[model samples]
Target chain A: MSSDVLVSVRGLEVHFPVRGEGIRKKGAGVLRAVDGVDLDILRGETLGLVGESGCGKSTLGNAVLRLIPSTGGSVHFAGTDVTSVGGKGLRELRRRAGMVFQDPFASLDPRRTVAQTVSEPLEVHGLRSGRRERAARVGELLELVGLDPAVAGRYPHEFSGGQRQRVGIARALAGEPDFLVCDEAIASLDVSVQAQVLNLLRRLQKQLGLTLLFISHDLSAVRHISDRIAVMYLGRIVEIGPASAVGSDPQMPYTQALLSAVPLPHPALERERKRIVLRGDVPSPSAVPSGCRFRTRCPYVFEPCDDVDPALQPAGAAGQQAACHLHGVVGTPVERTPEGVTAEP
Target chain B: MGARSGAPRGSEPASAVTAGTAPVLEVEDLRVRLRTPRGPADVVNGLSYTVGPGETVAVVGESGSGKSVSVLALLGLLPARVATVTGRAVLQGEDLLTMKPERLRQVRGPGAGMVFQDPMTSLNPVLTVGRQLVEGIRAHGDVSKEAARSRAADLLGEVGLPDPKGALDRYPHELSGGMRQRVVIAIALSNSPALLIADEATTALDVTVQAQIIDLIENLQADRGTGVIWITHDLGVVAGIADRVLVMYGGRCVEDGTVDDVLERPAHPYTRGLLGALPDLARPAVDGVVPDLATVPGTPPAPTDLPEGCVFWPRCPVRGDARCEHEQPPLVQIQGLDRHFGPSGLPHRAATWCTEPTSDTGLPASGTGSTALGGDR
Candidate 1:
């Protein structure tokens, strides 16, 4: 691992067991939300994770932050294995990392004031020993997110959607953490309000020298904020590369189709662009296809894709890697997933 | 006009030339006042638009912008007590706003169909997909149960559902989000309705599924010449699907024009701001560096507390004129446009003070917010 790597994850798995009918024993079915994934977030670099629902991008993000327990593998943060930490070590880890959720409406407590929400993080970390100092810090954090400090006494319902999201950011940044994970942070906001929040986040990241793991299903929104992009399929990363390369010339067929499916706002360009529409819906994670998880919907499916799962290998572009057998090195034997039925359309 | 004459014609789509005349639905000075806890709020204030046969008119706006409410009013779906809808909604020849309850009910399914964002909103959880589709079909015609069942299967096939025969036996919960949406679309189209009002129908689906649904709707509309009202906040979907676009802000039609005219050469500052906010995939970043995203500061005003002046005056980046603060702007025709999407030839219009040479926006004549946004992304 490089010295600049702030957080590293290896072979992470988050499988959820399914139950039959009303109350049967743990069924044979296991939903592999994040199946054996490897990822790394470099210091001061924004890593964008993109995928559709049920693709495990959110689970991978939550696991890296240690917000949820992982089934297997490891997550290393600042030279420590976060997955194994407990008690004081975990509390210290929480102080060092923060997260911003997708829905501001649900994430915030309706009863709490903005100051209380922001100051609670400060109190939990035992920072700013006095109440006055904590209040000042809360005011500063609110201003940093472009909200008025005077409004800190108001409840979330008193503010607009954009303002409430700013309060959420203030609470997240109250920890003064070096790393932040924004999981669809701006997805719930309006198009105009989304830009304001995006700008605030970019400015904050640069100002504080914070590394961000920006995860979103909206491809267009994530493309601008991310330095590097990672595309996730059923439960695994299929492609990872610079944002420009991934947006323009994606190596994996799934990424190509995903990018193509996003309709551009430009009328002339939208009409002229060639769309590579896939055949069917994404297969259920419980019954994932054998070999390449994306092969079931991949237009460039070949013989090796039927049984041999391709590993991420160096692509033609610099610092780019893809898991498709078509672009990467062949003959490397990887574990094969069980055979499964096709998706129901 | 009654249901028969006002209804859109057969499967053959009308040509571009015939679209300007004989509009299927014409809404004139449409207004809706909802009795809220605070007070009576004017949600839709004199909003107007016309949808011709085979044309898809997109009503684009964010939440609380009254895009959805206006359509509900036109269809007489709003409750009488909670909402006071006063508008001239002429469908074919009959006035929907003045029609009796029985007449309005008759105009709902066979005359106009509806698709919502959540497929479950339109589907019955306990009933099978086939049963719901059959019920909707049988309600309009004198068809037998077996005939309606066959038609329901055919509708499912048309919406691209796999194994249409087997799907008839499955409940709504048995299908995926995309499949359930397809089933809903099948039910909506079962009666061969002349009009379809889809309110964020594909917003919940994934992009791949959204693309499929968009294509399906476009194909169905073209073959059947169904007039469509697509209510959404996503501009990308509008650019791809809409023949004409009506932009709503604070329950008013802020901008109205053909898709090419409105999207490519937006005249209103609100429309320009909306375009600047969205990250355009086609707009390549200069040298490897992405420009800072443009933003319109502050949020839309609440319906109850809307400004007496221009609806967007509070958040308008190009509030160049002094009159903008004290007076409301009318929907004026935009002048000196270089090109037009001639098919609709529907004159581009905007309800703003800054779309003209007289306003002198003090920015670029292009008015695309290129400089304000530190070079558009």
Candidate 2:
């Protein structure tokens, strides 16, 4: 693992047992939401995970934070392996990490005031001494997220969508965690309010020197806040590179298509740009395709793709890695293909 | 002109040149007030717009900005007991507001079809996709069951649904979100309505699927000359599909112009704020640094209790003048600009206001204590 890496995940997999009909077939099937995936998040940097729904980006994030139990693999956070920890050690692991959810309304306690919600973290961790001190800390946290300190008395229902999200942020920051996993934090917000929340998150990250794992399906929002982006397809990280590099020149076919699919705000550019629209919906996770999961919809699929699943390998640019057969390693194709193998697509 | 001449001819799209004549739907001074527990909330203020034949007018607004309510009022979709709708919606030369319920029902699917945001809510869970499509088709026209079924199959295929035959038997829940959306689109285009209203149609689907649906709509519009009203908050999608853009804020059209004019050189403060707030993926990194997003300070006013004068005056950057505070700004047509502004000019127009331009150039930053935040991500 790199010295700068704050969170190191290796071969992480999360599988949920599928239930059948009413209640008869309890353990009928296994849905592998997050399959063999490896990622490294540098300290104080936002690593964005972008993919469509059911692609396991959220599962991967939850696994890293140990919010959900990982069926396989290891997640090393700070100096301890999160997967191996339990009881007191697990509580310690949680103290150093926090999660911000997608829906602020659902995530927050409707009955609890903003202060109670924010102060609960302080109480759980036993961070601040005395009731007065904790109340003051709660106000400070609310202010940090650009909310009025007086708003600490109001309940979740009293605040707007943006204000409720700020309260959620304040609650997350109350723990003073080094690592934060924001799972589609702004997905539910309006466009105008979306920007405000994004700006706030960025400011908070820089001010607190917090390491963040910002997972979202919205490519534009992810690109705006992420230092490095990892494009997930099915359950794997198909491409990982600097935000600018990936945004400008994506090596993976899935990454390329995902970027192209995003509609640019400018009308002229939107009309001019050609889109590589993927065929068919994303296949069910339980019945994932063999070899390469993306080959079913991949535009540049070849014979090698069906027979062998490509692993993340170095690409043309530094600090960039792509899991694709097109970027032949060492100026030669990695897999020896028979004649006419490339003509299949 | 109570003519049914512009009904579906063939699958081939109508010519773009024909779009210049009569607009498919013309709305004038549309207002919808909902009797909520709090009070009579004016959801849709006096709004007017026209969708020309084969033209796509994208109505962009945040939630509760009356974008959806305005369309619902035009279509008579809002509940009569709860909503008091007053508008003149002339569709194909007939005013929808004055039309009888029976006449309006005939015009709904055949005259103006609609595709909603959530496909699940729009579709029946128990009924098969085939049955629903056929029902919609046969409801408007005098078609046999066999003919309707075949048309449904063709509609499914046209929307790019895989295995149209097998999909017809499957229920709505059996299909994926994208597939269900396609089914919704298929049903919407069953009778080839003159006007198609898609309210956040692709908002629920994945980006890749959204692209596909967008392409399908554009293609269908081209072949059928269907005037589309795409109501959505997504500026990016609006840029790609809309011929003209209508920006709604605080239950009114703050700005209206061509997609190029509005997006590239926005004149209204709210429109400018919306464009500025968006995080552009195509935006070049400034000296290898991610810029902080500019935000419109303060939340939108409550619909029931909107501030006097300009609806956006509370959040407007150049909002210190007495005229702006006491009197609402009329939607003035900008001469030679090929666009319309609420009251002010571009940032250059801000220079004429009381406050001096704070920024280096004529573009005056909003004086509402709003900061342009940028940071290296």
Write model 2 residue lDDT over B30-57, tens digit each, in one string. Answer: 9889999999898888888888888888
Clashing residue pairs in candidate 2 are B13-B223, B292-B373, B292-B374, B292-B375, B317-B366
The parts of candidate 1 lying over 4 Å away from their true place are A21-26, A331-345, B1-21, B337-345, B356-377
Tell me candidate 1's interface RMSD.
Answer: 7.3
TM-score of chain B of each: 0.89, 0.87
lDDT of 1 by residue, B1-377 (tens): 11121122222232442345688788999999999999989999998788888888999998999999999999988999899999799988889999999988778887889999999666899999888888888887899999999998888888889889899989999899989998988888888877899999999989988887887887788778888999999999998888889999999999888887788777777887788888767765788778876677778888998998899988887676776788888887765443322335567788877653322211224442221111111
Q: How well does candidate 2 score on lDDT at residue B167? A: 87
User: Which clashing pairs does model 1 show?
Assistant: B1-B93, B1-B94
TM-score of the first chain alone, every candidate = 0.94, 0.94
RMSD of 2: 6.3
lDDT of 1: 0.83
